[model samples]
Target: MRKADRPLVLDVVGDRVTVEHGADVDVTATGRAALVAQYSRGNVMSRSLLELVRQLDDGGYRCVVVSTCESPEPLVWPGELPAATVVLRRPNLGYDFGSWAVALDRYPAVAALPRVILTNDSMAGPFAPIAPLLEAFDTGHTDVWSLTDSYQLGRHIQSFFVGFRDGVLAEPPFRTFFRKVRVEKEKMDVVHRYEVGLTRTCFGGGYSMSTQFRSNDLGVGAENPTLAGWQQLLAVGFPFVKRTLINDPSTAPGAENAAQVVRRRFGVELSDWL
Candidate 1:
């Protein structure tokens, strides 16, 4: 990692860093990969998170998890992650985007994979097999695939769950984008600069994109579909629900029914994820 690329921690935690090395799986041989960014205040892995990784691995993705926690020590593993899953621990600093930037830098091999999925703990479930759909989408018509697209800020692939195909990661602009990613103090600033900026970069580089749920089909105006249109998304067999919708029901209208609705629809108890 370059000195400049190293994350600049602004907190009083000093420069404490922990890098738990894992057996690096050659992504080139794996054919499919996932970079999952995670953050836990107590350094404990949640069941929902464990399920996410397991599902990805079951779908043939070599997963690399970059976790950020208050403590410098590694995250508490649930003993469920595949043996090949690489876990890296870092001080909570630049949010998910920051953690992802660190992972990309640490494992350049992920960039070479023919298909790669970038996701985070901000959402819940693969309640269904999504890898086949992603593989289907990677046939070259789309350079990027996302579970859902949003229009709150602009038309961009929602960063929480997205896939990159056909060497989009190898593009010079794509690499430069991650290289230039910095720690943004405000949450919205990170969303604007990185989340939204990512799709814009792809567009500039002439990369095509697709989404499972279209914003127009879900919601309108500047509302987030995963929040405002979650029920509709779920009704359409969308396998995941955003954490914001469940963590604080008041954050989104009708989210108060998440537990009941999810249990009835997907037959998976929401309390399990909570």
Candidate 2:
């Protein structure tokens, strides 16, 4: 495998966490929010992630960026970070699931808030305005929602961009699921047990769930809709192209042209990430 395709192995120690407050982070800001779980080896924040953060900020959500990285190095905030947002640095353990679990535990009060978006830096672009999507999530009747759904290994909302409203957030099953989340070394284990598992937990708890982009609606067949039908997704204003498509286009046979397609059509440059 090429270097970029290698699985990341961080210096993980069991559940050890440390916190840092950005110079101007709204330490007092609390309420309806978005928990953006991020992992960056070079400590550089991507422009796409930054754009997504700005959109959430504009949408009136408190942004809590959780960077799951090697421990002990102080997190240096890029001046580009919004002043209102805060940063939480922890040891990389359970991927995005672990980061979200830690962030959710840190801010217990967020559960009571009307809406909470659990997202991460797994994809690129907000090439389009996210206002419409956020509006649908807020007003939609579903207890849990996501940008898209996939039927890959069993139906589940793609974990990269899931939303939790009041009902699901308050459910015991929701809290219990996170409380029981363990650090898994294998990425697919994290997916099956946490990513897909969260969706199962929500349904088992009797919570209504929906997605802005349904798997069937895409009319595409693949384990991952984002990777298989990326062009179709973008054509529908999906707002993001899976980052893996750029990192290793061969992961999806026809997606090798994604970098150029995104640049030419959406005017979003993903070449830097490649």
Candidate 3:
């Protein structure tokens, strides 16, 4: 088979991308290549996804299926795709980010035989104008790529900072605890006192560390039974209170920027495969 005619499979993870070959039994082995894009319903951006489908079709890709978190029925724009291209749908596993991790881990088995071109849903726009889909196939760098330039990177950073600040202010222990204590109204003093007791027990006793709250009501506040139960587990002999604040920027810009700075200081561009 000609190189241009080889199959291509795309594994999309919201704004992240990973690529692999399709399996022998899959559509790619039948000579018609496939480009699969995973869509999460929780994601607010769909325009880029739609554009990617259109671009792939225009570039003569065989299949353009959008796996969305909606129903089994995929949203297909027939006119936007070529006759050879087919759109199919599979059920999305709700709005869980972990679902994408599960999907990417399994993608190698699902589309292992065909030539793969992995890209993020966000890359669809930059790709739409420059045939980025074709570039993925041409350069053989389909694992992951950044579509936006440095300016957009700065904007994204600013937005993240603002959101983080707002989130910190709105956090339960910080906002709710302080607000109730400051408000001197005696209409429901007992309830407020009870809340203060629980808060004190959790934080003051060092039981709230590394604990996550689970709530029965989707909209209501969470309850950390483990923290509540931990109060009883503390040994009387080891009465030293050790409080640690877990703030990890490693998952975000701290590690990323550090790596970037190292590369820049060394006057090198980090290899993508690393």
Residue range 1-274, candidate 2, lDDT tens digits? 3435433323233345555655455432655689899887766667778888889988888888888756356655434767688788877777887787777787777766788898988888788889999999989988899999898889999999988887467568988887677767688988888888988998788888899988787776656889887888888879888988777878775787887888888776776532
- RMSDs, each prediction? 3.7, 5.1, 23.0
Candidate 3 residue lDDT tens string, 192-249: 3423333343354333221111122112223221122112212111111111100222
Query: What TM-score number comes out for model 1?
Result: 0.89
Reference-based lDDT, each prediction: 0.77, 0.78, 0.30
Off by over 4 Å in 3: 1-26, 29-34, 40-47, 64-66, 71-79, 94-114, 120-128, 140-274
lDDT score for residue 269 of model 1? 85
Give residue 158's lDDT in candidate 2 (0 to 100): 92
Model 2 earns a TM-score of 0.88
Best by lDDT: 2
**Candidate scoring better on TM-score of 1 and 3:** 1
Per-candidate total of colliding backbone pairs: 0, 0, 9
Write one digit per residue (lDDT tens) for candidate 1, span 5-104: 5444332223444456455655456778888888767767777788888877877888888787666655676655687787877767788877777777
Q: Candidate 2: which stretches are off by over 4 Å?
A: 1-15, 23-30, 71-79, 272-274
